[model samples]
Target chain A: MKNRNIPKKLQDNLITIGIVVVCYILVMILSATGLLSNLLQGLLVPLCAYIILAVSLNLTVGILGELSLGHAGFMCVGAFTSAFFSKCMENTITFAPVRFFLALLIGGLCAALIGFLIGMPVLRLKGDYLAIVTLAFGEIIKNIMNVLFIGRDSHGFHFSMKDSLSLGLEEGGDVIINGAQGITGTPKDSNFTIGVILIVLTLLIVLNLINSRDGRAIMSIRDNLIASESIGIHITKYKLMAFTISAALAGIAGVLYSHNLNSLMATPKNFGYNMSIMILVFVVLGGIGNIRGSVIAAVILTLLPELLRGLNDYRMLIYSIVLIVMMLYNWAPNMIALRKKAANRFGRKKEVA
Target chain B: MALLEVKNLSISFGGLRAVDDFNVSIEKGQLYGLIGPNGAGKTTVFNLLTGVYQPDEGFIHLDGEDITRLKTIEINQAGIARTFQNIRLFKELSVLDNVKVGLHNKYHYSTVEGLLRLPRYFQMEKKMDERAMELLKVFDLDGEADYLASNLPYGKQRKLEIARALATDPKLLLLDEPAAGMNPNETKELMETIRFVRDHFDMTILLIEHDMKLVAGICEELTVLNFGKILTQGKTSDVLHDPEVITAYLGE
Candidate 1:
C-alpha cells in the first residue's frame, strides 16, 4: 500500500483528465466525419461551461455540505464584469486571447470579492435559512444588474441607476453596459478549447483541495461539526475557503459563457432561483461529493434534450423519468441488493469459466 | 503549576445551574476521572473546559495561560483535545483520513501550496499519512485504514475516535464517556488503552465514565459530582466508597 498510494493519487486525477480528453476527441471525430450537426457543435462550449458550474457547485453543495442557492448570482457577477471589461477593451486590445484572459481575471476576482462579502453574513445561517438567504441574494444581484448603468468617456467612467442615457458621455464614448439590456457588441472569444482548459483547471483546484489538509478540515466540518471544532478546525475559515473558491470557479464558467455570446443579459430568468435549483440538481444527480460523478452527470443532463430531440413533446417527460430512475438506482435499497446479487453471480461465473 | 486549573466556573442554561462553581486542578501527567449519575453535568464541565460553552463567571488556565473565553478551536490549539460522548468520527471518510483531519493544523502549507500540489504539500502530507498510520497501528486499526470509519464495528469506531483525538498531539486529552456502550471485555481494554495513552504520551487525561470499576483501576484521582457541584474529590478508591458519592449514584 505504501508505493501504491502514490499511483493511486495520480489515478484519481487521470480519470477526470481522461474523461475530458475522450469527450474532446470524440466530438472532433464526429465533426470531422460530418456526423456532428452544426447545432450540436455549437452546444459544446455551453456544455463545458455548465460542467464547470456543476463541478464547482458540488464543492459547496456536495463536499462542504452547504445548500447554496446564489450560485447563479455569483455567475451573474462574473458574466457582467467580464462582458463589461471585454466591451471596454474591444478597440484597444488587438489580440482576442489576451482580452479574454483579462476578462476572466476581472470576472473571477469580482465574483470572489462578492462571494466573500456575501458569505460573511449568509454563512452564519444554516440549512434552509442559508438556502433562502442565498436565493434572495441571487435575485437581488440580478435586479441590481438590470438597472445599473455605466459608460466610459474622455472624462473617465460615469455610472448611474436611472438608465443608460443617464451616463451622459462624450461623443464616441463606449457604452459598456445598457440597463436591463445587458452588455452588447462583446466579442465572441470563448471557444471549446478554452472551456475545456478552464474545466480541467477547475478540476485541478477542487481535486487538489480535497486531497489537502484544508480539504480534510472542510469535510470534517461537514461530517461532524462538533468533533471537527474539538479537533481545532476553524469552521468559518474553512467554510469561507470552500465557498469563495466555489464562487471563483463559477465565475470562470460565467466568463466562458458571456464570451460565447455576442450579447449577455443578467435577466432574472437567466440568473435566478430556477438557475440555482438546476445547478443543485446537477450536483445531486451526480452524487454529492463525487467529482467524477458531477462531470458525467453534467454532460449527460446537458446533452439529454438534444439527444431526445426525436421525442419532441416527450423529451422533458423522458428526461424526468430518467432522473427518477437514476436516483432510484443510486439510492434505493432493493435496487442496491439486486446490483450486489448480479455482481456476485458474474464473479462466480468468471471463477467457473 | 497544574497543567489545567479551573476556579469558580459557572454556567446557567435559562435558570438551572448546569455547572456551578466547578473547580479542578490537574497536574501534568495525571490521569483523573469525573463520575456521576445522569444530569450530574459531567459532560457540561468538559464542555466548559474545552470552551464549547463560555462560563458565566470563572477562569480556566491551561499550562498557566488563561483560556476561559477562548473559542473551541483555539482551546484545542492551546493543547486541549477531546472526544464526544457519542462517537463523532467522520463517517464517510476512510479511517486513515479521519486521523489525518486531526493533523490538519499541525502542517504549515498554504492553501495555494495545496492547490498547486507543491513539494511542501506532498512532504507534509506524506509525513501526516505516516503518522496517521502509526496512530492507527497503536489502536490495531491499521489493517482497516482504507475502510470507511462508519463501516467499522462499534468498539473499533470508539478506538478510532480516540486515535484521531491523539493525532492532535495534545498536552491534555478529554474523553467523554469513552466506554459508554462497550461490553465488559471492551471496557477493560479501554482502561488499558487510556493508561497507555497517559503513560506513553505523558499527557494529562480527564475522563467521565459511569463504570467505577474502570475508573478505579486507572484514574489515580477522582471527583464525584451531584447536581452540577462536586460532592467529593480524593483518591479513586476513597471517592468511590464515599457515602455521599454512593447516594448520588443510587438514591436519596
Candidate 2:
C-alpha cells in the first residue's frame, strides 16, 4: 500500500526533484574525490550562506519595507546558541542521532525570540531611526560577547591566541577577539547535503509564506501603512511576524555556519552591523521584491571579491570600478538606450544606401 | 440606537484648534454627509473619530462602548472602515489582493499555518477568495480583479477603493471624496453604487463629499462646516439652501 501511494506523492515537485537532487549529489561526490576545482570548493559554503541571508533579509527590507542594519546580530545569536548546545551535548549518550537538528531548532528559537523582542519597540521608529537603533543593538551584542568573561583556565581564562588558533578562529595572534575570542570546537557537521537540504526547505517555507494571505497584508502595509490600518490590518502583528521569521531563517544560517566552522565565536565582533548592511546591499542590488534577484545578488557579491584577486595590487580599485559600473547600469533610466542609438545609426546608413 | 455619537469632540494641533467642540449623532442604515469649504475641519473630524488623532475634549460612542481613544486598527475592527481623500490602494498589488488584505481581519490563522499552507489555511483562503470575488462582482469589478490598482482608469480606481473598504465588512463606512476625478457617466454609476451599498449592507455612511449633486441625490441628512465649525445641518434640502453653508462652503 505504501509503495502504491509513493508514486502519487512523487509527482513533479516532491519526489522527482529529490531524485534530481540525489543525482547532483552523486556527481558532486565523484568530482570532489577526483579533480575538483578550488574555485568550486571555496565558492560553495559562502554561496550557501548568501542564499540564506539575502532571501531572509529581503523579507524585512522588501516585504516590510523597513530598513535594518543588524540582521547579522540574529545570525550570530542563532550561531552561538546552536554551537553552545551542540558543544555541551557532544558526549552525552542521550543526545545522539538528532543532536544536530535539536541544536538548529534551539538556535532558531533563540534568534526568533530576540527578533520578537527587538521588533516590538524598534519597528515603531521609522527610517533612519530604526536603522540606527538596530545597528546600535548589534554593536551592543558584540561588546557583551567580548567583555563577558566565563571562567579562568589553567594559564589564565583559557582565552589565549594559541587556544583560539587551535580552535580555528585565526591563523595567528591577531584574531581580534582576544579575551573574548570566538567559541571553538563546534562540531563541523554541515556538508553540501545538509546545506542544500536547508536551502531548499527555507525556499519552500518562505515562498509559501510570501504567497499566503499574511504576506499580502505585510506587502500592503509596506506599500501604504495608513491604507492598511484603515482597512483594519493590525500593522504591528504582521511586522513582528516578518521580523520573527526572518530572524529564524538567519538563525538557521548561523547554525549551519557554526557547524561548518567547527570552532565558534561566542562573540562575533566582525559579524556586526557592517555584515548586516552587506546583506542589505545584496537585497537592494538584486531588486527588493524579487527573491530570484536576492539569491543571485548574494551569489555574485560573495564571489566577486574572490574573482577580483587577479587584479593584484589594484584589486580593490578594480572591484570598486566594477561595482560603480554595475550600479550605474542598475540606475540607468533606459536600459536599451545603446541599442536604440545603434539602431538609429544603422537606419541612417540603410537610408543613405 | 445611534450608530455613532460624538459628544463635545475637539482636536488641537498644538496652537491650532482643528475641531472645536464638534458634536454629531448618526443612526444605523442612514446616509449622512459632512460638507465644508477646504480646511473647515471636516476631514479632521473624520480623522479624530477614526483615531488618527484623539479628541482632547469629548467622548465618541460606536454602538454603546466609548471609542474616543482606540487605535485606528481597533476602531476599524469595531466596524468602521474608511477611504482616503487621496487614493491609497496598494498600487503594486492587484485589486483582488488589495481587497483580500482588507479581509485579513476575518481570517484566523497563525503565521505557521499560512506558511505551511495547511488544509485549514487553504479552506479559509478559499472562503476569502470567494468573498473578495463577491465584493468585486457587486461593484462590477470582478473582471478587473487581477489588474493592478494603479493601472485602473481614474473612475475604476475610485470604485476599487470603495470595494476594498467594503471587504472589511464595516458597519460604518467613511468615504472622503469618492468622486474627485470621475467623468459624468462614471460619477452617475458611482452614485448608484454608493446608494446600492448603503441599502445592501444597511450601512451608516459619513462622507466628506465636494460634489453637491452627489450630496443632494443620496444624502438624507447633511452637516456643513465653516471655519472649523458646523455652520448648518439638517436634511440635505435644508442645508444646501442655508445662506451660511452656501456662502462659506458650496462656493459662489
Candidate 3:
C-alpha cells in the first residue's frame, strides 16, 4: 500500500533497476568467494554489452514501432571508431579511464550521426521496407569496414580503401586499421563494472524518455500514425530522435564490445546480418516494448548456449526449443490468457494474506 | 467571424471527385453537423478541414488566418483537433498517456531535459497529468485513467477520443461518426456530452455522422452532402425536413 505513493511508472523503473543491482551484487559475492567459474566470469562484460544492445534496439523496434535489421551496423560503427581512437591515443593519453570514457562518447556520437543520416530518408519507408533497407545498410557498413585502412605517422592520419601499404606513410608509421585484419592492440579499458554502469545509464535514458512528453509522442505515432499526426505530433522528428538515440546506445554497446576483445574485426560472424538478427531475437523473445523483459531475455539467451556447452551436439537443438517456448510464453494467445488467469489468482491470494 | 470558414474546398482521388467544391461556414460556439450517405465524401470533408487531405482548390480560414496550406500538425497547432471514424486510440498506452499525448504541444521540455530528469521535466509532466485528469473527469473516465485505452468499453473509447481532442485546447473540434457503433442509449448520452462540451468549453464543433437522432438532438446547423456536393444547408429541423435533403438521404 505504501508503494501506491510512488507513480506506477517510477515504481516499475525502480524494480527493473533493482533486479539489475541484485544480480550484480550476487555475481560480485560469488566471484569474491571464488564460487564463480572463470568461464562465467569471462561472460560478464559481454552480457552487459548484449543487454545494452537489446534495450537500445527495443527503443526502435518495440517503442518506436519500427523494424530495423541493421542494428549491428551501428554497433560496428561504434566499435571501429572507438577502437581507432583508443589505439591512436594509447601512447598520448596515458590514462585508461579518461581515454575509454572519451572513446565511449566518440563511439556513441558517431553511431548517432550515422543513425540520423540514415533515418532521414529511411524512416519515410515503413514496415518491411524499413527492415530490408536497414538490413542492407548493416551489411554495407560491415563490408565498408572490411576494406577500410588507416595509418598514422608524423603527418596526420592516412586513409585508404585499399590495403595498408596504399596508405603512404613516412618512417615509423603505425597502421591502426589494416583492411580485413581490423584493429589490434586497442587498450582493454572495458570491464564488468563499466558494462553494468552503461546498462544502468541506458536504462535510465530509455525509461525516462518513455515516461516523458516526447515518449508519448513517439508511442502515439506507433499506435496510430494518422491520429498522431492530427494531434500535431511531429512524425519525422520523433522517429529520427528515437532512431538516433537507439543507434547511439547501440554504439556504446559496441565500444564495450571492442574494448572487451583483444582484436576488433568486422567479420560476417560478428558484425554482419547474423549479429543483427541475433540482437533482434533478444528483443523479440524479451517482449517488444517491454524494457525489463529485454534485459532478462538477453541475459538468459546469452547464457543459455554457454551454459549448455556440455550438451555439445544437442546444444543448438535445446536452444531452439527454448526459443520456441519463450516465444509462446511471451506472445501466444492461449499462454497470454493463462498468464492473466494466474496473475489474477495470485493477486487474490495476496489480498487474502 | 465564423470560427471555421471553408470556401470551395475540393479534392479528388484518381478519377473520382471525392469531395467537390465543399463549402461551410461555422460561427463561434455553434454545433454544426455534416451528414451524408455512404461514399458521399462526408469524412473526406473532415479530412480536408483537418489537413488529412489537402484541398485540390479553395481555402480554409480559421478565425481570420488561412490554414488551407498548413500540414496536419500545423493545422492542429492552429487550433483544430479531430477524432477519427475508427477509434484510433493509442491502444498500447494507458488512458492517461493517450490524453497526455494530446497535451504534448501545450507542455514543453527538451529531449535532453526529459532524459536527464531535469526539474523542468518534472514540473511540465505534473502540469500535464493534472490537465489530462481534469479532461478525463469531464468524460467520467478518471476512474480508468491508468487502464490501456483499448481496454475501455466501446462507448468510453469514443468519449476518451473526444477528451483527448479537447486536451489540445482547440478552437474547433471535429468528430467523425462519433456514434457509429454505439447503442441508442450510448448515442443519447453522446448527444448530451456533445451539447455539454459546446456549452462548457464555449467551443465550435463540426461533426460528420450518420446518426440522425444524435445529429438532430445536439447540432444547431446542418449541411447535407450528396455526390460530393452540398445538397442543402440550414437549421437542423429544416434541413431534416427539406425534400431535397430527404431525397438525397432516402433517394427519389
Q: Point to the candidate with the largest lDDT.
A: 3
Best by TM-score: 3
Q: Candidate 1, which segments miss by more than 4 Å at Cα?
A: A1-6, A310-353
True contacts kept of each: 0.71, 0.75, 0.76
Q: Write model 1 residue lDDT over A157-273, tens digit each, in one string.
A: 999999877788889887788888888888998999899899899999999998888988999989999999999898988999999999998888999999998778887556877
Regions of model 3 farther than 4 Å from truth: A1-6, A311-353
Native contact fraction of candidate 2? 0.75
Q: Arrange candidates, best DockQ first.
A: 3, 1, 2
TM-score attained by model 1? 0.95
Better of 1 and 2 by lDDT: 1
Worst lDDT 10-window in candidate 3 chain A: A1-10
**Colliding residue pairs in candidate 2:** A182-A265, A183-A264, A183-A265, A183-A266, A186-A262
lDDT of 3 by residue, A106-225 (tens): 999999999999999989876687798889999999999999999999999999998998899999998999889999988999999899999999999999999889998999999999
> For residues A1-353, could you state the per-residue lDDT of candidate 2 as single tens digits?
01111123224235423643664487488776975567766557656766788889999888888887888888888877787777666767244438889988998999999999999998776667667877877777766665543323333322433334443332222232333656667666666677777777776777667767888888998999999988888888889998889989988888878777745554443367667767877887888766667777777777766777675566446545655666666667674586567778988898899
Q: Evaluate candidate 3 and give its CAPRI docking class based on DockQ.
A: medium
Model 3: DockQ vs. true structure: 0.61
